[model samples]
Structure formats: C-alpha cells, structure tokens
Target: MNHQGWGAPPDDKGATPFAYPEQPVGGFPGAAPGVPFGSEPGMPQPWNVTDSFAFAWNRIKADPGTIIGTMLLGYFISNLPSTIARFIPSDEPSDETSLIVTIVLALLGGLFSTFMMGGMTLFTLNVARGSFYRLNDIFQGGPFFLSILGANLLIGLGVMFGTMLLIVPGIIIALGLCLTTLIIVDRRCGAIEALQQSWRLMNGHKLNVFLWWLMAAVVSLVGILACCIGTIVTAPLLQIAFAFVYLKISGQTTADSVGA
Candidate 1:
C-alpha cells in the first residue's frame, strides 16, 4: 500500500493504491522509465481502439462493485432533481409557479450532473491507472469544481457556436475537447489550459477517438436491446475505456504499463 513513484506497485491481488497529485502539473507527472511521452501536435501516434476497451473490460471484471456501484449512485443522485419533478403536479400548462419549479429543478439536475461527471472522471482515471477506488471517490471532485465547470461551460459554448456555423465544426470541437474534464482533474489545470492541452493531446487522434466512441455506442445499444439492465456493465465499460484511452494517448502510466 506504500505509494511508489506515481502509484504503488500492484499488490498480491493486483490492485494499486490511488495517489492523486497534490500540486497541478501540465500533464501526468512522474512518468515511469521507458514510457514515451505522446507525439508532438502534428505527429501521429499509434492507437488501438480495441485495446482500450479490453483494458477497461479487464478492470471492470476485477472490481465490478466499485465501478458499477459508483456509477449507479452518481446517476441516481444527479437525476434526483428531474426524478422529483415528475411527481409534482403539472396539470395546467399556464401554471407559472410549476414552470418555475421545473426550470429550477432542471438547472439543479444539470449542475449536479456536471459535478458527477467530474467526480466520475477522476474515479475512472484511477480505475484506468489500475489504482484503488471506492464509492466515495464519486464525490471527491469538489476541489476541481471551478475548473471543471469553467471547462464545461467553454466547451458547451464553443460547440454551440461551431454547430451554428456547421455541424462538422461542432463535432470536431466535441472530439477535440472530450478529455478536458479529465485533464483538469488529472493535471490540476485551469479550464482554458485544460482545453488547450486536450486539443493538443488529441491532435492526429480525433478520428480514432470518434471511431472508438462509435463502437462504444454500438455496444451500449446492444446492451439496451438485451434489456436496460445490461447497461450496468456497459456503462462502466465505456467510462473505463475512455479513461484508458486518455491515459494511453497522453502517455500516462496505466495499469497495463505499471508492471512493464
């Protein structure tokens, strides 16, 4: 359980302790020897879409309780506002008070949803790195709240503006910024800094990310077809897969790379 360089070596059970950095850095600090940093902005780096999913699947199998339990709790709590809104009386369309309540609840849901996303992003990063994680890790994103919120807000506005110009720009912006929240939490960077870093990190890999996302979406759809219950597995699989890809592409030490 002793923290080594970036994280402790895997114990007998193949689990490492979670060790987040206290001070923010430009990227994941303390790279292990022989691990190459990612390519320059214009250079293409090899990426395997399936490998990321395989890594995620392995981790989920190793710790389904923490993975699935955290996801479920975050999902439930984030949606509470909307869930409660459904039970409120709404028989009249012109009810100003009811309308105001609905708007407020929706806003609350969105705020909680953003925070949960940040918390889950951090938790999943730990999972991807093969570190220990617990259900409470889902609520550990408070420290990065301002940065996360700012990054998300900027991304939303940029994407919206890009979409107004053309749909492709919006998609491109989204792909480029997909890892902003992760970067903010992982590197302790500000919103604009995280956005720029993500954009640079994703260089030459956006297509691969998009393709991987498409595959994940298909997997989720299949799970839904089997019955929504299957999402418990598929959902965490997606989260871990995303974290794995981010670690791999950004040259951070992952569970798979720890021993090697």
Candidate 2:
C-alpha cells in the first residue's frame, strides 16, 4: 500500500508495510542471528522488564486515544468465544451438551483471538516504530490466521501436558513457547518451526520470561481493578512492552536503547 502522512486521506492500497530491521547474524540486535539469546558477551539484556514497562508507558501516552481504542477493539474480538458459547443450544437438564459446546466455542474463539491479537500486536509494533497505520490496520494480521491457530494449539497442548507432569515444568514450557506467536508473525515461519525457534531462542532466559509474564499479569490485574476500564490501557501497554522486548531481544534496539 502507498504510505501516507498522518491525517492524510485513505488510499486503496491498504496497511503500509513496515519491514523488520535486519540483525547482523543472529536475530537479536548485537548478536549473530540464529545464536541463542544472551550468548554474545556485552550483548544487551534481552529481557529487561523495567525497560519494557517504561517504553510501554511512554508509547501509550504518546497516542492514548488510538492505542486504547485499538486495544478495546482487540479485547472485544477476543471475547467472542464466550458470546458464542452463550448462544449454543443446550439439551434440557443435560449439562454434557453445554460442556461440549463450551469447549468447541472456546477453541474457535481461541483461533479468532490469535488473529485479532496479532492484528493489535501489529498495530502496536507499528506505533512503536513510529510508522503510520490506519485504525483498521490491526486487521492486517488476517493472512497468518491459520498458521497462528495451529501453532497456538500445539503450544497449548505442549504446555498443558508439561503442566500435568508438574506445575513448574509447565510454566517453564509456557514461557519458553510464549514467543511463538510473535515469531510466526515477524519471521513468517510455519507453526512447527516457530514453536521450535521460540523454545530454543528463549533458552537460558526462561526465568526472565517468567518474570516478564508475571509483571504483565500484575499490570493486567491492576488495570482490571480500575473500574474494569483500565484494561484497555494496560492490556495494550503489556503487548507493546512485549513488542519492545521482542525488538530488544532481536537486536533491533541498541544496547543503550530501549527500542521505544
């Protein structure tokens, strides 16, 4: 699509493509691409929770109205599964039908949720990069919808099975695999490779990933507490924080830069 300046009229060419910055050899900023995270000496910390929040807060303030609105849109789309479940036909006095319907709807919701989440994520990343995007640009992730659905399912099952063995392993697996969705989006990799790359790429940094996840959860809780109105703000903040982290880990940001 033809890129335009802010406030310019829309063109038929849709969302402006923002190419991911190239790293030297490794995918991260200072390290060789394909190397494990944090392997290169003097490389920037790939998982700085502090910088993530700092960047998120600043980006949100820069475009409070648009960011919050996009986040709300994502949040609404992600909840459609529950809405569908509510409409499923139930056999009188039999809860089995309802249970089955719930699972089916949840699965479908989850599939759609990935696409919607990816759209919002692309939106946030564009914002972080200081590029222009329409409010509707979030839907641009539609192309990778099925890939994410499969990858998400595999990761979920893997994590679920791991968790069944013991809670610790499950959390570790979850954190390690958490970046799979982003990988699929940015790298244009398939479901299996994305999952593998995420697990391996995060090697030696699972604890930090857990920490970031914990922080994100806390922020989400705080947002929910704010009259259930703060989520639109905090949710996107968390996603942008992750986006910034992704850039940092991928070496798009300098050691001295937060990549905001």
Candidate 3:
C-alpha cells in the first residue's frame, strides 16, 4: 500500500516532503514580490541632467512604435482646435464672448494633452519595466486613468498659474513636479501622494531631472519645427524613456512600481 516513489518512504525518519520551492512571485531575487520590477529595491535611484539625456536616447531606441504613435496623436489633437477656431472668423461675436470661447477652447486643448500624457506615462512605465502592454491598455477607462487625468489637469493648472507670477519659477515648479503622473500611474497613489512622492524622490536630483526635461523639450522643439509631424514618432518614445529614467533614478523594479 506504500505509494511513495522508490528509495523514499512517506513517513520515514529524517524524510523531507517532496515540494518545489515557490518561485519569486512578482519581482526579481533579493527584491520583494508583488511589486513592480527592474531596479534594485529600497534604494532611491538618483537621476540628474545627464541621466535624463541618456534616458532620452535609450527611449528612442527601445520602443519606437509607442513613441511615434503617441507623438502623432498628440500633434493631431493639439492642432484640431486651432484649425476649427480659424474657420469661425473673428467677427462672429463680441470681443468678450470671443475671448471666452478662445479660453474654453484652450482649456479643452489642455485636457486633451493631459489625457495623452497620462496614457503615455502608463505605456512608458510598462515599457521601462519590461512588461507586456497593448495600445488599448493605455485607453482602457478605469479609476487609475481618471486619477491620472485629474492629477495632470491640476498640475497643469498649477504650472500655468505659477507662470503668471514669473516664468522662471513656473518652469522650475513644472520640472520639479514632472514625474507626478508617472508616480500616480505606476504606484496607484492618490493625487496628493503622487505629488508628495515626486517631490520626495526628486529632492537631491533636481538638476539632473531638469537636464532630462531639457532633452525632452529639445526633441519637442524638433517636432514643432517639423510642422508637428516629428512628434508622431517621438512622443511615445520619450514618454517610455521618461518612465525608464524614473525606474533608474527611483531604483524601483517593475514589481515595486506595479503590483503583481
């Protein structure tokens, strides 16, 4: 009646159960499971301007498909309002009404940009962590998506309001808070948590972060110069690369950022 394999008995003295050790669930070895994966855990990764430039280059090479698609989509959407506004003619309304319409249109445009940015951030984080993600995953509506969009809008408004005070301060604030979207999207943090976390992680690396921001700005300028066509290819790439930079600087592995 013994069912044990040859050379072993089920209840023999000093016998150990035949069981395979569980594989690490979410992350790589030496890191906690059920978190996002890529960088070493528990240590804050530092990124400076140099890292930003390097990240940009890396992004261009890593996922060109996403980069190009996001860029093109952004360009087309951004220009649509302006094109429509042009056809409306300036003489159609009182000056105040026209101004209101213009402002509303601008707000709409800003919202569109925020949506695109949020989607791009998600995609970028996915790529950086070496996770498989589909384009539809970016657009799938969810609480996370709504949170990201709200956060982006708030941040964008802050930047705009700050700029009204002084251009330089606004630029600094914008850069300081640039990673908020990624933080929110990757960590599923609330609006305020993402903002605070971004500030905390960025404490010593502002200069380096600015450098990467500058590179992205430069690439963006190139897109502008190409009559917006260049963005069709660069937007998604830069976004994912930015995510990669966040991973490197934060030292967060894929599992740490994204749960299993």
Candidate 4:
C-alpha cells in the first residue's frame, strides 16, 4: 500500500483527488482512487444503523489485532496521567500540594484523552474507508490537536450552557456536536466550521443518530455488567461503528465502496 506522511493531510496544492486538504491526517493511508468530494453517488438517503454496525463488525473481525491493539494502546496512554496520579507519594506532600498535583493530573488526563480521541478517529476513519492502517496511526493526531482541542472547548461550553437553559437542550447540543471531532479531522476545518457542519449534518437525522447512541449506551452498559472485560470489546466496536456512521452521513467514500 502507498503511504503518505503521518502528520497532516497534504496541502490542497499537493493533495491527490482521493485525499482531503491538509490531508486531514486521520491515518497514514496511500491515496486510492475514489469519488470526488461532494460526489457520493452511493450516499445513503437514510443510513441504516444495522448496516453501519455490520460494517464495523466485519472490519473488526477482519483484523482484530490492528484495530483492537491500536485502540487499546491509545486508551492506555491517554489514561496514564490518572494512573500515575493514583500512585503519587501522598506521604511527603501537604494537603494543598497534593490537591494541586491531583488537579494537574486531572487536567492532563482530560487533554490526553481528547488528543487520543482524535488519533483514534483517524484510525477508525481509515478502517471505515478500507484504507490501510497501522498501530502507530493513533499517534498521528498532532496535526489535528488544535482543531480537536478547540472543538472540545466549544462543544463543552455549548452543552453546558444549553444544560443551564434546560436538560433537553443540553442533550440536543451534545448529540448535535458529537461529530465535531470527526468533521475537523476529516475536513481539516477549524473548530467553529466543524461544529457548524456537525450541527447542520444532524438537522433532520438527530433521531437516527440518537437511536444509534442509545444502542451504543446499551451495549456499553451490558459490557460493564459483564465485569468490565466486555468493554474491551464493546469500546472498539462502537468506535468503528461511529466512524462508519460519520462516513455515510458525510457522503464520503466508505469501506463498502472501496473496490466497487
């Protein structure tokens, strides 16, 4: 497979027809021919959740090692801050010092988790598009760091404000902006643009996306009920499913059309 640089998508001047501007570094996949942007002939009129989930399942089953391993590694590294904070030597530290350290660690953990989410999005997008992916693709989120971080902040504030107005608004905002990260990573757009695009994308499809989220929540709850070990499986499954949903909703060339 032909591989491009791992950082960011190539600039528009250098991008091939198959790639996005700034190469929206989701994963390091070689450019393959595909429908041009804005031309998703196979785009679903009303995407099927079952189909998305099935595509995710098939992809996972096809190569559990790369898919699961990359996700696991990203999760592990992202949580390292909290893991280390738990082991901090509390004996020698004053209460205030300990509290400060805990706050710092908590902040770091959130940032790491957000950063890893972007990386994972990249990897998952590769899978959704039937592009070659590697375990290291999870570390190529640096190019998307600012976009992801900004979007997160904006989404968080929007959700928080909406919650203050009423509980329903908060839920709506959360669902609407859920695809912000994927938009930013996939389109190389800034935070505001991605958030706007995501909001617009869900204009008439909120119910469908909500149902998908509900299904994911149930699966995750079941995984938790199954002694937490099941999360190791459910987590990656849902992640891949989400990528498929994003690709279909955004009218991009999905895994289903790779060789067609």
Q: Top TM-score: which candidate number?
A: 4
10 residues in a row with least lDDT, candidate 1? 1-10
Could you tell which candidate, 1 or 3, scores higher by lDDT?
1
**lDDT score, residue 203, model 1?**
84
- Determine which window of 10 residues in candidate 3 has minimal summed lDDT: 1-10
Full candidate order by TM-score, most accurate first: 4, 1, 2, 3
Give the 10-residue window scoring lowest on summed lDDT in candidate 2: 1-10
lDDT of 4 at 20: 23
lDDT of each: 0.74, 0.66, 0.58, 0.75
**124: Cα error in model 4, Å:** 0.4
Q: What is the TM-score of each candidate against the true structure?
A: 0.82, 0.73, 0.65, 0.84
Q: Estimate candidate 2's alpha-carbon lDDT, on a 0 to 1 scale.
A: 0.66
Q: Give the Å error, residue 82, model 4.
A: 0.9
- Over all chains combined, what TM-score does candidate 4 have? 0.84
Better of 2 and 4 by TM-score: 4
Q: Each model's number of backbone clashes?
A: 0, 9, 20, 2
Candidate 4 lDDT, 1-260, residue by residue in tens: 11122233345533333332244433335433563322322444447778877888888888888788889899999999999899877776667888898999999998898778777888888788787777767876765666778778888899999999999999999999988888776666667777887898777778889899989999899999999998888889998899888877876767777761
Candidate 1 lDDT score relative to the true structure: 0.74
Per-residue CA lDDT of candidate 2, range 1-260, in tens? 22122222123214434323333543333232233322322343555788889877887897788888877877787888888788877767568878888999888887778778667766765565444544675676664465677777787898899989999888888888887776665555567766776777677777776788888889999999999778768878888888777666555542225333
